[model samples]
Target chain A: MKILVCISNVPDTTTKITFSLDGKAFNTAGVQFVINPYDEYALTRAIELKEAQGGSVTVLNVGEADTEPNIRKALAIGADDAIRVNLKPTDAFLVSQQIAHYAQEGGYDLILMGRESIDYNGFQVHGMVGELLGIPTIAPAIKLDVNGSTATLEREIEGGKEIIEASLPLVVSAQQPMAEPRIPNMRGIMTARTKPLKVVEPVGQDAKTSVQNYELPPAKSGVKMIDAENAGDLIKLLRNEAKVL
Target chain B: MSVLVVIECANGEVKKSSLEAASYGSKVAAALGTSATAVAIGDVQANALASLGEQGITKVLLDNDSRLHDFVAAAYVKVISKAAESENSSVIVLSNSNIGAAIGSRLAVKLGASLATNVVALPQINGSSFTVRRGVFSGKALSDVELSSDKKIIAVKKNAVDIETTAGGTATVENFSADLADADFATAPKETIRQSGDILLTEADLVVSGGRGLKGPENWHLIEDLAKTLGAATACSKPVADVGWRPHHEHVGQTGITVSPNLYIAVGISGAIQHLAGVNSSKVIVVINKDPEAPFFKAADYGIVGDATEIVPKLIEAAKALDK
Candidate 1:
């Protein structure tokens, strides 16, 4: 089985979001980028599946030159090779098309991706890619396993979960409890330095939507501090003034 | 051309998020000088489907497919796409739930339409171009997206829009069918497990969340009592849920269920950016923690720097007293 894992470079969760270019784009100044948290789960699970099933794992990303460093980081975490789609991923539709094109060409048995990228948070690609490739897509799976061509997964629903079984040549958007994400050791990091890193141009359709402007959430008004000694007063304020209850 | 809304129904009732979607679609239709038509999926009562007219939906298309009793994405896409084409829909609206996101993306590709998810507001029509503001960076900011394609599809975030009801409204329900092939049901879940007797965190109007500060799972009774008093759903931070202190479905954060309840009362929890991302859209936030410097206090509308273990009981008593 040849497994494909998709990753995205997103600002760390703690980064304070800011907009620049007169609110046309996100300001990247001084922001640190990491592999999206959800994608980490996919990457780690793909590696585990490869280790047990005797197959190869390849990492894929859609980004510009600056994202190369993180692509290399994904390789260091034990992917056999990497492919960077040389384009700024603007929308989920276009990105999924690119991924579908590559997956079709690779004839990969299993395709894996994060449920959504933290940057765009467009939880659209998994199903789009599945539809594009005419395959089944199980999203936000918390548990995934391979049992000789059939995969059983625990899919997360709103207030519960569902257990599902699907055959190979399927796509899955995985989340936590799939596997603990692996960090690069010195040996893995050194090996990744020489691994094949291929750069390919975007071979996908045009984006349907574009960002016209960006704005920060309204600055929070200062909070009202209530004394702990008078705990009941907080409930009183909630009922009478806040009126949320 | 009209607006097409997908109303997801399960166990004979429309999901709350779908209700929001219906309202959003109708409002958008009103804005565009058109009417809204709804397509209902899953086994639903006829009266329940027609009741959507209260949300401004004028017509309802009920698929009544037994195969779609559970969520079959492939079949669902075919059903919604058929409804859109039949209505000559220029705009499609859906709730940004899991099913909506899954189907909306596929429809966008299949129809070559501009798609936006996590939308918080209606589209602002500017001649030929329409722009929508959606929550980006997990509620940290909003981005105005321009849909350049002639066809537009929007997935509104749950609880972001208020529901509108038109009194004495009733819709005409029409039986609809796509006659989907068996391949569509191939990915249907083998088993579905639902949390019984617990308020759904995503649809709950009020949520009382706990964290590691609650000490251990055994002490969860404190949190439950507060939730019970306020008739609210219960949630936990990622770490607490990861450590098996709470069920995964009860976890709320960037990686978990992002909620926008009317009232979110967080107790014994430090404000992580991820956790805040889930609930920052809440109308009112109340935080109780022992640490005065807990970051949650900064974002909370009201806060008490005290031991949640001590304050929660008093707050519950105060809540119970309100009935008196």
Candidate 2:
């Protein structure tokens, strides 16, 4: 069972988001990029599944050269190799197409990805790739297990979870509860340098959507504190002053 | 050409998010100066589909496929694609749900349409060009996206559009078939297990969510009782789910389910931007936290700087006193 995990380079959760001077694009200056938190679950789960059954885990990313650090980190965490599609991920469609192009020839038994990228918050790549390849996709799956050729997963739904089973050569977008992310130790970090880092050119697809502009949200007003004992006063303010009630 | 709206149904009724999608699609249809048509999937009754007229839908196309009662992404995409072509729909609308996000992306690729998920507001149509403001940065910011395509698909965020109830309006229900092959059912669910909850997150009028500040799993009963009294659904932040303190289904964040209820009560949540992205669209946000510096207070309409253990009990009492 060979697994391919899709990872994205996104700003750390603690980074303060700001726009460039023209206010048209995200300002990346001085911001540290990390493996998208959601993708970590997918990578970790893939590694675990590979460990249970003898197989290989390959990590894929669509980004510029700056994304190699996180790609190496995924390798250190136990991916057998990595694929870097050398292109700035402009949109979800182009990224999905790049991934699908790779998966088409890789003969991977399973493909895993994060539910959504934290930066763009576009939850479309996994399904788009699945559709392009004409395979099944189980999205936002919380639990995943592999048994020979069949894989079972529990996908999160509105009020419950849906248990689904699919054969090999399927796509799964993983979320929390799938597995705990493992931090890279010294030994793994040393071994990651020797792992193969394959760089491929992107087969571009026209992005149907483009960002017109980006705007920061309105600054929140200062906190209005009331006595803890007078908690009911806050409710009154919500009903009368804010009128949101 | 008409606009097609996919109405998801369960238990003989339409899902609340589907109603919101119907309302959104109708508005899109009105913008295009055409009527909105609906495609119903699953084991939904004809009478229930007719009720979609309240949302300004004129025709409801029913597939009546029992296999579709359980969500199969391949089968659903095929059914929706057939419906869209039959109606000659250039524009499609859906609720930004797990199913919607999964299926909408594929449909957009298949139909060669521009797709936007988590859309919060109506489209700004400047002649033929369509632009929409969507929540980004996990609800910390908004970005205006221009869709430069002839066809467009928009997945409206839950609770972004008000559910309009019109009296005595009924839509014509017509049976349709997609002629799915056995291959379409190849990925069907071998088994299904659904957790029973009083209120669904997408449809609930009120929600009570907990976070790591709730101390541990043992104190969850306080949050549960308040949710029960208010007839609200229970939810949690991503960290709570990551730590195994709560079920992953209850996790609300960029990674979890994005919901917009009338009232959202957060207990012991620190209000991370990722978590706020999922609930920021709620009509009213109430935060109960001991830390005054919790980031959630900034986005919350109402804040109580107190311990959840102390405040939740009082809230349950206050709620119980109100007539159901």
Candidate 3:
């Protein structure tokens, strides 16, 4: 069995956000980048599946060369090898197409990715890739179990959860409670230095969407503090001022 | 040359987000100088369907597929695609819901349309170049994206647009079919389990959430009492869910369910950036924590420094009194 896992590089959760060049693009200056937390769930689940079922896990990313370090981190966490599509991802459409092209050429049976990247938060790539490859896609799955050729998945719905079943050669967008993300130990980190990291040119489709500009959400007003001594006063404020009740 | 809105229904009525989607599509239709056609799947009341005219829908094509009562992603894609083709729709609109995202992305590929998700505003259509503002970077920023395609699809963010009611008429209801096949049902869910009686967190108007500061799961009664008193939903921070203090469904953070309730009262959880990403969009935020320096107080509209165990019970008592 062979598995493909997709990972994304994003600003760490604690990183303060700022834009550069007149608010045109993200200012990465003095910022630490890490694997998107959701993608870590996907990578961990893929590694677990490979370990249990005896297969190889290949980590894939669509980004510029600067993202290679994060790719190497994924390899250290247990991905057998790595592949980087050499380009800055323009949009979800083109990213899905590039992934689809590679997955088709590689003929991997199970493809997994985080439900949505923390940066773009598009949540479009897995479904698009599934459609591009003409396969079944299960998204935002919280639980997955494999038995021979069939995979059963548990996904969230409106106020509920649904159990679904699909055959092999399937794509899944995974969420948490699936597996615990593993960190790179000293041995794993040392060996990952020599792991095969391949760089290939992007193929198929141009970005259909382009970022015209960007803006930050309005800064929060200073907190309207209420004393804890008179806790009942909050109800009055919520009703009369906030008028939310 | 019409705008197509795909609405999801359960039990017998339209979802709030779908109503917003209908209003959004109808306005798009008016802007395009064409009618808006609605295609709804699953079980819905005719009266409820006809009421869509309030959102400017000209006609509603109802596909009462029993199989659709349980979401089948492939079947839904086929049905919506057929409706779009029949209406000659240049634009398709849906709620940026789990169901919508699942099918809309595939439909974008199948129909060869440019797709946008987390859309906050209507498109600024200039001749052929359509640009839309969408929330990105985990709702930290808004990015204006130009969709350079003749066919375009949009998944509107929940609670993004105000529902328009001035259309002030009833829509024509038409029973429609897409001749769904067995293969389309292949991806059908085997079983579904729902939260019994509480309001759904995402759709709730007021949410009462707690965190590890409550001390233990047994103390969750304070959250429940407050939620019950205010008719609000309950949610928790990631750590509260991670340590099995609360069910995962109640988790509200970047990695969990992102909600935008009208009022979010957070107790005990130190505001982490990931947690803020999910609940920051709430209209009114109230924070209660013992530590004055807790990060959540920064984003809160109203804050109190106190222990949740001591503060929550009194708040519940005060809320019940106000109700009487």
lDDT against true structure, model 1: 0.90
What DockQ would you assign to candidate 3?
Answer: 0.80
Which residue pairs collide, candidate 3? Answer: none
* Evaluation by lDDT, superior candidate among 2 and 3: 3
Model 3 lDDT tens row, B1-324: 889999888779999899999999988888888999999987787788998999989899998878889988889999999999999999999999989999989999998888999998988977777899998888777899998878889999987788888656899999899999999898788899988998888778899999988989999999999999999999999999989988888899878888878899999989999899888878899999999999999999999999988888788878888954
lDDT (tens digit, per residue) of candidate 2 on B1-324: 889999888888999889999998998899989999999887689999998999999999999978899888889999999999989998889888888998899998899888998888889987888998887877767899998878888888877788787888899999999998888988777776766646787677788999988999999999889888767889999888878888777888876777778788899999887788788777778888999999899987678899988887776665555443
Deviation from native of the Cα of residue A221 in model 3, angstroms:
1.9
Give me the runs in candidate 3 sitting further than 4 Å from their true place. Answer: none
lDDT of 2 at A119: 83
**TM-score of candidate 3 chain B vs. the reference:** 0.96
lDDT for position B317 in model 1: 90
In candidate 1, stretches whose alpha carbon ends up further than 4 angstroms from where it belongs are none
Which of the two, 1 or 3, has more DockQ?
1
Find the 10 residues in a row with the least total lDDT in model 3 chain A. A14-23
User: Worst ten-residue run, lDDT, model 2 chain A?
Assistant: A236-245
Question: Highest DockQ among the candidates is held by which one?
Answer: 1
Worst 10 residues of 3 chain B by lDDT: B159-168
The clash numbers for all candidates, in the given order, read: 0, 0, 0
